[model samples]
Target: MPQPVPPSWKDLGKSASDLLQKDYPIHGTSLEVKTLTPSNVTFKVAGTRDSKSNVIAGDIEGKYVDFKNGLTVTQAWTTTNLLRTQVELENQIAKGLKLDLATTLNPEKSTKAAILTAIYKQPSLHTRATVDLFKGPTFTADAVVGHDGFLVGAEASYDVQAGSITRYAGAVGFSAPEYAVTLHGLNLSTFSASYYHKVSKDVEAGAKAIYDTKSTTRGVALEVGAKAYLDNAAFVKAKINNAGVLVLGYTQALRPGVKAAFGLALDTTKLNDSAASTAAHKVGASFTFNS
Candidate 1:
């Protein structure tokens, strides 16, 4: 069997912030209230509901920073049948090194799990190593090196108790003002390449191809997508894949702190069988209020 390729910086997809700003319905109705003071103290409360599942959740969190000691503390609570608490402490050990310690506790069960992480940074390279001291020990480490427009990264994970390496991946990529490309691999047998280009000031296009070396049939898939920015704080994106699946989404900001989005997905192959099963769609709206 082929050893898994370690993860590198190249595997990261669109970030949550990007998706949220694009009005993706990944999160249903969300409301957040936050307060910050001059002394680096902060408090926040957020609530969300899943329109499809009708599940609701809320979180309350607070943070305090001691700049003189280079330390910060954060605590959070999640509302549920049994309340869960999480606490984290971060300290800067030196100019370019930091440590993070965190734990999650379930009061009802009196059970807890801890995590420790160390991060180091330099002008051209960054590294992070983390350990989970839970039921079974696990370790993960990754590093990235970059200069100018080119970058490369590698990542690996091990199961300490099992005494074996479990995960590995890597990526190499470059970005220019007008174009970007990345090659990523997993477990030696699976690989993918992606390319993106700025077609114009308001439009962008991208494509991706994936291959599995071990597969006898259906070993490859391809997808292409594009985005267009319209006037007045609105944008649209569309994508299609070799499997005859298409997705289209549109987002618009009505005013400050208010946004709405709609998305539609269609399987052309399913259309050939039945029209009712061919299309799926979702609509979402969000509002934020700050004091």
Candidate 2:
């Protein structure tokens, strides 16, 4: 009998993933209270120095709306982000939708909620890109008494996703330690909170907590991060988790409507009981333009 083994395990995909952006979300509307009704689009091309490699470029087309008060609404048609980056070409064509809402209750208090869902166009060997939705509510307060800025917020979500695993149903069957395996379920939750305070006019620090639970396991990672403005040309920041994982990042403003940012992080993961620990060091950079 021929033993089962992974076929065609190439580093083509692995090498391309290393040089992508860490934080793709654009930031600037943090404390602004104006109606920002506009349609935005962006593209990012990432690749290594290898001439034989293809640069993976992604495009995000979305619309953002902010009311005169503190109410905010955003709708997006994102090609791929967290879930879509893993699979092959057929899976890459999958599509998703996101809706978000944020409002201010008082001069120093606020609330927010969001819903996101995505599904694949076709089933691949690994997964069919199952449907997943996240819905949660949060409350926040900031700058209560003589503080430059302060905030405390919490939220939770119930999510469902297609199992990223597959099994062959034949006499030989898929090679596994067990005959029957748990496929997929809709019972998962994630909770998170953060509090930010400004120490000076050009620097700020914050603490955050993120707790995630799946059908099989649960874990939490705590983080501390800071941002500094080094004049108008350069800035740097750093962060780390309780598990000794580290993240260092920086962004530089270039010209009037163009800027770039980069980040690096280290983490580990275990796929199954028999699987060995996989260590990954990731780096990403992004450029943006606005008129």
Candidate 3:
């Protein structure tokens, strides 16, 4: 009996959560362009704006991969306080093992941080550990074990300076060809459950519910979503939450390497209110090109 486990405990409910949250929408307009060069380098540029007139944020990034040494290097510059630079390196240590090192530096603020992470995996087990080299020398670790389509996992983090545990969580899940479900307890105070189902070749649906044990209001937050494939070139998604918030998204391929996405979010409870601005409604669009 072979059961595949998630990379980390945090991914226990990733499938259902992604279905309900991912590709839903953004709050502003954004565009991304990328190209791969013959020299084995990839370059990307992305920009975002609150309105159609001016660009509010943007970044340019480059990445190179060394297949022989199993290493990848990435560098990025973003518009923040003149500019911010981020560098990352990932290397495969051995079979089923890898290490990732990343750093972010802000010259204007004179601030920088570094992090290191290691990942290991086997047929029925997976584990990951991370450390913040400068801040608290914090330590975070997680592991998952699976057997016969069932999985269990746990994760915890500790801050060396605080001399205490910062957070802890656990999860259990079952995966099948047609459906998957997961239940998790987060930080010993919050609980969540999720389910994903594939109805047919072209339709999929998912739902998630979360509850806070510390909340006086015993209400659970629930969200349900579905994705419908219209054709090979286009798709549509819709989701609604317990707060009467409805979201819709559509993505279409304009050509071989170009795609566009449009998203809208509305508050049904605010529809009857006399005063409603952009607060009650939000819309955004995104375009992507890969060459």
Candidate 4:
């Protein structure tokens, strides 16, 4: 039998988090437009405006991917007149090993770089390590072990100059075709439980609860979300948090190569409060075109 590689430690609870957060409606007024060319280059412009319709903030970014050389380059300019660039190179070193190097540059700030190495040793063992060089080098590593449908993983980051561990976390999860569950902990203070279920071919549902032992509040923070595919080219998603914050989004393919999305966010508790009505709702839209 072929050895099936397991997910990285960072992605242990990704399924649930993605359902609850990713592609969800944007909060506040904003618009984003993106265009992708056939030559593997993407151009994007996005911004939000104030009540007077004056552009308040935004950025323009362009990215190009060179598959023939295993390289990707991204550059962006912000409304603040800051220029930033990122370069990434990736390659497979062996059957189950891969190397990735990435660098970030900002003339206004500082430059940073990191090298990541991943190894899939067997059907049950997978490991990833990253070394960030610059502004106090740090070493971070994580490993995931799987047995049957169960998985356990831990991650830690060490500061070389300080000779100390900055962060540590662990997670355990079980995966099935229809459902998955994960429990995670960070530094023995913050804990989270996430569950994802595939309700049907067209629908997905997920929920997550977070509890901080050091939190002054005694209750857990909860979020529940779901996604439903209306057809091949349209989908809708909604999520709500414990604090009565609700988010809803709908995406549709406007044409063969164009897509549009509309999003809304609302605070249910403030709907009838005149003093807080002004901040009770947000809306945004996005469009994408790909060749």
Write down the TM-score of every candidate. Answer: 0.76, 0.38, 0.93, 0.85
TM-score for model 3? 0.93
Q: Rate the local accuracy (lDDT) of all candidates.
A: 0.70, 0.35, 0.84, 0.81
For this target, which candidate reaches the highest TM-score against the unseen true structure? 3
**Candidate 1 global CA lDDT score:** 0.70
Report the lDDT tens digits of candidate 4 across residue range 4-34: 5667898888889899887754643556778
In terms of lDDT, the poorest run of 10 residues in model 4 is 111-120
Q: For residues 52-91, write the lDDT of model 3, one tens digit per residue.
A: 3456898898988777777778888888843433333334
Off by over 4 Å in 4: 28-69, 73-92, 109-122
> Which pairs of residues have clashing backbones in candidate 2?
20-284
Instruction: Kindly list the per-residue Cα lDDT of model 2 for residues 55-174, writing each as its tens digit.
Output: 343333333333232222333222233211221122223332222222212222332223222221111111111222222121211110111111111112323243222221111111
Candidate 2 similarity to native, TM-score:
0.38
lDDT-superior candidate, 2 or 4 = 4
Q: Across residues 253-289, which tens digit of lDDT does each residue of candidate 1 receive?
A: 7776556666666676676555456233334544554
lDDT of 2 at 212: 65
Angstrom error of the Cα, residue 70, model 4: value is 3.9
Q: Which 10-residue window of candidate 3 scores lowest in summed lDDT?
A: 81-90
